[model samples]
Target chain A: EPEVTQTPSHQVTQMGQEVILRCVPISNHLYFYWYRQILGQKVEFLVSFYNNEISEKSEIFDDQFSVERPDGSNFTLKIRSTKLEDSAMYFCASSEQTDTQYFGPGTRLTVL
Target chain B: AQSVAQPEDQVNVAEGNPLTVKCTYSVSGNPYLFWYVQYPNRGLQFLLKYITGDNLVKGSYGFEAEFNKSQTSFHLKKPSALVSDSALYFCAVSTHASGGSYIPTFGRGTSLIVHP
Candidate 1:
């Protein structure tokens, strides 16, 4: 079973620094998404990417957030300026056509 | 907007017993429901989904969920609980009217604890 893979399982960054979280979705998936979960909170949708463009985004995905395909295999999320509240577990997910999404192990970001 | 409600914060069950995690949903059109499980420090794992057709949907890890259209509910059930089954479970919903571009709305999640 092919699974979505993410790099830098855990990251620690300064409050004002920029951070990039990378993900490689399933080889044949056409739709990709990013979600985040604050500690003890529900997983929140950040953005969705298709055809190398953002399809939809949530309020949490404000000016500081951007997503890029960059390459055929790599999808990344970048935060221009991190805040303490930005610390959370970020997940990348993919799907073929159905709504059933397969998720990666996630990247834990810690800001101090 | 599509939304999901997981009323219970946590559910405790004994090993070898049946366990259920409740989920209710609200959507404008026909709803597509899903259940996912997350272990500590890991991402969400797809458990099962109900798109159309049969109300009973079977999924990985010996889990199943029944979709009740009348109640707008999809609840996950496992016949026998294992210690490994202890994890955080989430319920999600999306509507077909969104033209497949809609992002799923998730619930607050329910923690399941299986005691031996």
Candidate 2:
């Protein structure tokens, strides 16, 4: 079965630096989403992207966060001026329609 | 908006015994419920889903969930538990919004520990 794949399984960055987490969703999937989970917290939705535009975002998804589907296959989430609290496991998910999302392995972002 | 609640933080079951993880939801309209499992340091894996029709939905790995409309619950159950099934399980509910997108809301998660 086709699955979502993310790059650089682990990322370490300085608090003031920028970080980009990349993911390649299933080949034919349309809707894409980004979610994060703190070490021992619930998985929180960051943003959802469809038709190359942000469909919806959570309050946690502030100005520092942005998502882009630069190409047909690559979808990326970028965080600028990361804070200490940004340390978490970021997951990428995709679905053909609006239901049943398939998730990627996730990238552990460590903002020191 | 849709919300999911997993009442138990952890559940312990002896191997070969049946196990059930409780999950309830509150939604304005119809709910699309899903069950996912996560192993240590791994991403969430889809176990099963309940959209409409059929009160009982069977899923992956000898697991099944019964959808109780009156109770507003979709609980995950396994007939026979195994040590390999020990992991963190999450229940999510998706509700369609005006924009025609079904955004999912996840519960805190339930930890299942199967003793051999």
DockQ for model 1?
Answer: 0.67
lDDT of 2 by residue, A1-112 (tens): 9999998799999999999999999999999999999988899988888888888888999999999999999999999899999999999999898988999999999999
Error of 2 at A11 (Å): 0.8
Specify the highest-lDDT model's number.
2
User: For model 2, what TM-score is found for chain B?
Assistant: 0.96
Q: Which sections of candidate 2 miss by over 4 Å?
A: none
Q: Which candidate leads the pack in TM-score?
A: 2
For residues A6-102, write the lDDT of model 1, one tens digit per residue.
Answer: 9899999999999999999999999999999998898999988888788778899999999999999999999999999999999999988747789
Across B34-115, the per-residue lDDT of candidate 2 in tens digits comes to: 9999999788999999999998999999999999999999999999999999999999998875555677899999999999
For model 2, how many clashes? 0
